[model samples]
Target: MTNSPAGHTPNVVLITGTSSGIGLHAAIAAAQAGHTVVATMRNLEGTRALLDAADAAGVTLDIRRLDVTEAQSVTEVVAGIVGRYGRLDAVVNNAGSGHLGTIENETIDQVRAVMEVNFFGVVGVTRAALPHLRTSHGRLITVTSVGGVIGQPFNEAYCAAKFAVEGFMESLAPVVRSAGVSVTVVEPGAVATSFVANVGFDPTAPAAVGDPYAAGLAAYLARAGSSFASAQTAESAGSVVAALLDGDVPPFRVQTSDAARQFVGVKLADLDGSAVQRLTSGWIA
Candidate 1:
């Protein structure tokens, strides 16, 4: 097990998707806070960016290759961490892909693809690490989105997957609490990142010829552009995950920014689903 300068045992944090964005930032933040971080991504070649950032910040991470979509990869990485550290204290499920476009525009394959990464990917990782987590009485932090709480227009598939994640974690939280494991879902609103681009959506592109949903899509794009223009930084979002990992008792649900809180608050405050429908309808209208 790793030890801090003061000789206290340090937490061993496993963070997925450390190639960039929130994952990379969270790995650095955790390492800087004295936790031993095993930063994993689909491709080890992508570790250069994370390594450069960690070097600049004077933090070190044990980098590994892990593809959450692959069950073998998940099992191997988790086993390796436990073998080396003797315990796994926390897991940050940040390896996710976004899907844009309406339900009509997205094919069944595309929908399944998003679910594979955003929802089932979390399941794969959590299932693999839960044994070790239960042994250590550790934490499980998954980076969901505000869309998970209130589905946004043109984000049908992505939101559906996130909603599944939220429900799954919520249901598992109590069950795992008995085993001394905590489950927390970290929700973040729009952040300045390449997420949209990585999702293969071009907000500035001209609408597809003769598409019925073109107008609504354009409107959603405009609103997303404005939201991202004033979006929070990736580092800000990562800090939320880091904080939850370091906390003795983390809340079941947390929003990274106040804007995220406000966005998700609307849904939590509404007993009926009408308020969210009305708000979402306004975007298309």
Candidate 2:
């Protein structure tokens, strides 16, 4: 184990959703920073990219299968980690799913599916790790999106799930702090990843050929595409999570990039909700 600046022993970090995107990057970054990383995902079949990236970075990770949406999977993984490592110093809940559609267009089942992955998945992992975290004075970090703070057009279901996560963490932060565990929510703006393509919906696809919400959806997709063109890289965002895990006094909330900070700042600065309403209204108008 390595020693932190404060001389604390290196963390035994567990990060979920390591199959790709931010989770993959965070797992690599944490391992490079000297933490014992246990990177997990729902399936290990498509982990070649992650393995290749880690190899290029000269860091090795103990990869495991942990489906955060399943309570038994979460319990078994956490228990196994603790039994082997003797302590779990930190857990980064990076597993998430995305949905893109207005409330009028999406089925309730579709929204619930997003919640199952984004909200309940985080809850399962946190609950399973809580006892160990309390014992080790560990940290709980989650990779939320700017949508968590502001409702974006065509992202009703996705934002709702993220909003629920932010609320749950904000409320649980203080309670867990008393038990020596730090809770933090890291929000990122448009990240350049396969996330949009993997979300199981393509607004720009020809499938939306004659949908009622096509025009509005197309416009929103164009705007989002423009934003993603200049978005932060997954590796950059991952470094933020790594830094938080290494910090002795991490903040309760953080934005991975300046753009993210500015985006979230708008809603935070709106005391009357007028600014957000005006902006969101334009998206679907």
Candidate 3:
């Protein structure tokens, strides 16, 4: 969707991962757009940035605690919101993690940890809120990544989960729309955010004793660092996400920037997108 705002009624919006980055800005932007925002995070201990941003934006948000990976927490949060507001209008599944490891190096449990947060976390939240969304004719928006479209090295588990999210939402969109709930996924490319900081990957570190992938890891990290150095800001991407909430009909898919669009354009077509794929090939070369 374009960064154009549409006329919209105030909605009760539930957003996950509001402690920082896209989620923090998104919660604030949605509130600034006049939505009744419930900004939630896994732990309430880190509300500093979110609170500060809300204050700076001059918008009040209902702060709550929600862990998307926990079934009970997801269910209870959605139930509580409906009970408090008398209706539920929208949910933004923005809680996610960054993992930087290939399968052989990362244990099965580690991969499962990634899926639990990125994939099942989304499923849990969406499932819990679907009933209310159906009743309210509301929206379901997820913050997926460009990695969801174009798989990246060292992001196997992360990309797989995102790919599953994209596939699940794509398949559910039409069926859910028939029930009055709209589903949309916002895809972003490299963004200037704490996401990378949280990945725990140190290219400068000595590789584990005789790690076979050390050289490839270093090359990929160098290119990735450059991509992020020129990355779009979290606030810009957040605003694009916020704009979608007001439209009468949200696009089935939205890439938050030109880079994101060009990246995802690879899977959507066989033209210039192929050139983009070849560019990543050099990252591990």
Question: Whose lDDT is greatest here?
Answer: 1
TM-score of each: 0.95, 0.94, 0.94
Q: What lDDT tens digits, residue by residue, belong to model 1 across residues 1-285?
A: 211122446888999999999998999999988899999999898888898999999988999999999999999999999999988988999999988888777699999999999999999999999998888878889999998899888889999999999999999999998988889999999988777679878777777789999888877777778889999999989887888866457789999999999989899998988999998988877
Pairs of residues at least 3 apart in sequence or in different chains that clash in candidate 3 = none
List candidate 2 segments past 4 Å from native. 1-8, 204-212
> Which of candidates 1 and 2 is the stronger one according to lDDT?
1
lDDT score, candidate 3, position 158: 93
Runs of candidate 3 with Cα error greater than 4 angstroms are 1-9, 271-277
- lDDT computed for candidate 1: 0.89
Residue-level lDDT tens digits of model 2 in 1-285 = 222224566679999998888999999999999999999999899699899999999999999999988889999999999999898989999999777877776689988899999999999999999999888888899999999999988888899999999999999999998988889999999899888778788554574546788887777877878888998999999888888887466888999999989889989999999999998778666
lDDT to native, each model = 0.89, 0.88, 0.88
Quote model 1's TM-score: 0.95
